[model samples]
Target: MRDVKACRVCRSPLPRAGRGRPPAYCSRACQAKAYRRRKNPPVPTPAASRRPGRRRQIAEALWRIAAERGLDAASMREIAAEARVSLRVVQYHFDGKHELLLAALAMLNADNERRARARMATVDVDDPRELLRAILDEFLPVDEQRLLALRVFAAYFARSLVDPELAAVFLHDGQPLEELVATVLTDFGGIPDPRREADLLVSGITGLGMDVVHGRRTLAEVRATIAYHLDRLGGTGKVPGAEAPGTAVV
Candidate 1:
């Protein structure tokens, strides 16, 4: 008599086949699980211990790659090597490169938000000038960390132009950066059209930040330009001899 065979994955009894090749797993679910195990295995020892931090590790690796070598170089194998993990580990954490890209962008947005909040925490919220400065400062590549972040952001922004998935990360319905600046302007209590001014300021600062990142302008020059704009917006209690409202300042 033929001996009963067991499922490879669940070890459950396998139904006898009439005259075909023997079955491996008890069910399709088990079969898929077995395949996944063979494909990804398990993260080993110390790395496995820090499973929670792996996502951030992988995202940060992508950032470094994008910042230094450009985003196109950030393949799964390269990211895994950069993060010092096996490629399977990255695959285990993220479904695919596109999913990973979205995750990394989300992580970056959250990190920047946290940094902005931390910077603002030191200043009194009632002080619109200081609060506004804090918010804009987060955008500038004034230090090494911020510099790396801005560089990575530039890479993501470029890719977002063609990729709808990446573009979705930037497009959102809510109080955008401009609205936040506009709200602060409203508190400052002088600008006629806070929203329009906020829009221009935000756009101008973004352009200036990119300029600094590309070495076209020094940090000092960008900071001076920001200070000049803030002064016009009544940063220091409304500057004397400032251009009149509705007058184009050349």
Candidate 2:
């Protein structure tokens, strides 16, 4: 007697086949249905299937290499070697050095937004001050990853200023940051002019970040400076510092 079991697709009994994995469907109809289901699931619009995580890993490796060795010295071959991927793979994903650099910048922007949002969610204070403090505190050069990301961003920003082509992409990507800041301030602090307030806050934070990255200001001093600004902005008095709302800290 052959072992038999219900097919996963149509719940029909399946006969044992030659030595191999058990059949998932009982018959051609069930198999076709299963295939159709996999081919066209009822899920909402799926995200682009590009290997962004893989690309991000490669980009980070490239950044590390560029930092240790000057960007001029770091070639695609070297980047591929560092990332443990083939040169063709890198080229297939990016056109050239400029594209790779842009990709790296995109990765940095995305990672920063993710980290900032995560930190903000953990802050217990509902007042704009605490939220501002939370966002700025995440900017401090307290860790290697943050420091590296800031350095890359500053470098790209400088390069974009001189390169008109790069400037367009840089500005396009940066618009979101300003918008996000404005939204947060408007919602939390009842900021009258969200856009202007966002611009001002982003400018202040950027300048402060540059100083901190260059070791011109201590972490405590930076935090205090930002806190002072937050106090002036009505963050401190609005809501008492308490546990963050219900959300994963990061």
Candidate 3:
């Protein structure tokens, strides 16, 4: 039996008669109108066909390839293959591997910053404990996605160390976190040399992240280690050791 349906052309609530042909239009006139409309469908603009957008699609392809196979494998041909686009298309968007990697780095950094900002949006910067916690949380790879991002960082940073041009860009991007660490230390660490302490803390946290990523240590261990160091810095409020906040640097 034909099921109940609306007329395709007029949508006039036409019901199906028992054991009859399905109506494409409400009436003969509606059917003629529908045929005319079909023959003159509006043509979509070029921008409309660029739905997801080419630049984003290329970035996504490169990011996915780098994440899965490491940056070394994210070549122009490989990225083009991954995105199901031609090599010339990929090259049209990005000049070469370095430029592609830089774009990826920028995207990854922006994503991380966006997430961290959202997470710390309501954090009390004046509160020493809260500030320190937020700062540390931003650095920690608490989830698998974050750990994957770290791999991207590792790839670029390693390359940057040897290439001064890349190093300049990398260092500039890294300064914000370093400054944040310094601020937290100055306000909470209770140590005289907050700048030095900040550097040390950053170094320590970086190592802890490495261990966690390499599976040598767990997230629990990382937290424990951080807490231990923070306590030494007297982050709870007052300095704990025999050192004064100004005179004796703990």
Candidate 4:
């Protein structure tokens, strides 16, 4: 005698259809409902998801504090209050301000890198000047989010002045970018000293961002400056009316 099977959903006795296979559910409707329940369960989200959300809240609080006030103002207690979590919660995710600073920096850098990658995807990598323009645009504070992020960056730089560990993190963050840009300059600009050019361009782009943040220049003027600099570098003269190698367009 064959064993009787019950429906997975309604627990009703199941009648097998033909000799091919045993029925897991009594009816198609029951099977679909069961599958739907399995797919979209009513249970609360797992703790893993909630934990990251809490961590993000704390990090965002830290970012805001760093940007609005200073990193010094991002003490654990203040972060707890800002994040609306317990001080222990903040301490649980991050041992101290250094760890919190690193977390916030990771978030900030991730955002910047995401934007940079997206922009680079659409740009012409074969054209070095355009590539540099795409890369440096990510460095600029063209809009509100970038502006706030740059403010947070300013706060972090000031804090890193005295903290060697923070300085190390800053260097770690920048070294890869320098290497990448140097490689690009080597390929596109026919520059002999790619590293030197990369360093200069990185610093120059940073200064341009700072200038924009400080009201020293408009974003269009910044783009024009970048174009002028890249034009001097002279990748390929594909675009019409491109500036000459020695000329500064603006």
Candidate 5:
């Protein structure tokens, strides 16, 4: 005798058959119900799908504290408070404050990089001046988001001076940003010494960005300064009567 089978949906015993293939459902209704279930699955709960990780929540709390009150204020207990979690929860996610700080920096850098690329995608990449500007713009406090990032950057830079671990984060890219600037200068800007000009441009923008964060320089003043340097480096490659580089800040 052949072994009996149960319906996949209703668990009813399937009728024994004499043919080569055995049926899965006892009746057409059961088969149809199973098919319907497969076609239209239940939706997942919003919390189940959209919940942020505990580590990220803690890291973001650090970012907010760093931006608003400097990194010194971002103690473990303070971070947990900012995140509305217990201090033990913050400790659970990060081994220590150093690790949490590094994570926040990494996340900030990654987010800025992604946004910079997105911004560049909307522009004409063949225009080297525009491309370079796009890259440099990411470093400046052009808007609220960049403003927060620059604050964190300034705090980290100061701390990195005495802390080897934090300093490593600054040096992680191995001069890649400078190399990219040099490439753009050589290929499109047609500068005589691309590498030298790249170093100057990158450092100049960084200093100017920091100045803005310090409240010593206005955004307009920094743009004018940047425009002056771009003109001097011959990176602007401007034609007669064309608008000046960095004139209208993005």
Candidate 6:
């Protein structure tokens, strides 16, 4: 038997029992650093012909199809055709229809949240009320991303009513919104019952979003309606330039 080669980083004897290529590093840390360097090596962007992985490319194509047509309308065969892969390839990556839909929903939500966080970072409001307003407004159907997300969420919510597992995931995703509203009520609005207020705010937001998604109301109308309720709750007291109805006390 030939002698085993030592790891380049740690000088440890490489394992000869592995099924595949011999690792260049003895441990994960050195492996990660090496991967990072290789990934970011001074290669020109135009010369880099590396494309998205098959799974990622498929997922992206499916997302585009889903965004144009509802998920129910986007069949697996059509998605496979759009992704330029075999239908079996899609199935191999995802367990089933529901799992694929769940993955798509998760990816869409994550991308939306990332964009929302980036937009929120640009806001430098000192007042918590204004900050809350900015954050909440980001969820409204004011743009293509928000509108698409609202549409997808509404579809999932309607479907979740009949599917237990989907319902579980929906509830898990909604927890963050509830917590955000609770924080804003307690810290910014100075509400005595933050939990109750948070629930109410979440309910209102959900209802408004549904209405917008269904085309029952325009985004500006929904914003105005929410502003009316918010003015009564915390806006009048906390947000400047917001006046209380039937109050002479400025």
Listed per candidate, the RMSD to the true structure in angstroms reads 7.5, 14.5, 14.1, 14.6, 14.4, 11.2
**Model 5 residue 111 CA deviation in Å:** 1.1
Model 4, CA-based lDDT: 0.78
Score residue 238 of candidate 4 by CA lDDT. Answer: 30
Q: Write the per-residue lDDT of candidate 4 for residues 1-250, one digit (tens) a residue.
A: 4544777655676665567666787889998987887787755732232367778888889888888998888888998999998876776576577777887799888877887778789998887666777787878897788888999999999988999998998766548778888888887745667788788888889998999988999999988877776765655423336555323332
Per-candidate total of colliding backbone pairs: 0, 3, 0, 0, 0, 0
Candidate 3 per-residue lDDT, tens place, 1-250, comes to 4554777654567765656566666789988977876786645832232333675688778777766676678888988888898886666566677776776678778888898888787998778766776778666679876887776677766777778977877778556666777877777644667777788778778877877888899989888877766777764434456455444343
> Candidate 3 clashing pairs?
none
Candidate with the greatest lDDT versus the true structure: 1
lDDT of 2 at 15: 78
lDDT of 5 by residue, 1-250 (tens): 4555777665666777767877888888988977986786646731232234776787778888988888888889889999998876665456688877887788889888888888888977887767777788888999998988888888888788888978987758689889999998886544557898789888989988989988999988988877765665563554335587434332
Question: What would the per-residue lDDT of candidate 1 be over residues 1-250, giving only the tens digit for each residue?
Answer: 4544887655677888767666777899999988987788766732353356888999999999999988889999999999998886787678799988888888888898887778788888888888888788888998888888899988988888888867876665665889899999899876778998888888888889989988999989988888877887783335546565545472
TM-score to native of every candidate shown? 0.77, 0.62, 0.68, 0.69, 0.70, 0.65
The residue-by-residue lDDT of candidate 2 on 62-172, one tens digit each, is: 778755554555589998999998876777566688888877877777888888778777887556556656666666677888888777666666667888988898777
Clashing pairs in 5: none
- Candidate 5 ranges with C-alpha deviation above 4 Å: 1-52, 235-250
C-alpha displacement of 149 in model 1, angstroms? Answer: 1.6
- Clash tally for model 5: 0
Point out the higher-scoring one by lDDT: 1 or 4. Answer: 1
lDDT of 5 at 130: 73
Candidate 6 stretches greater than 4 Å from native: 1-53, 64-69, 235-250
| The best candidate in terms of TM-score | 1
The per-model lDDT (C-alpha) reads 0.82, 0.70, 0.72, 0.78, 0.77, 0.70
**Which has the better TM-score: candidate 1, or candidate 6?**
1
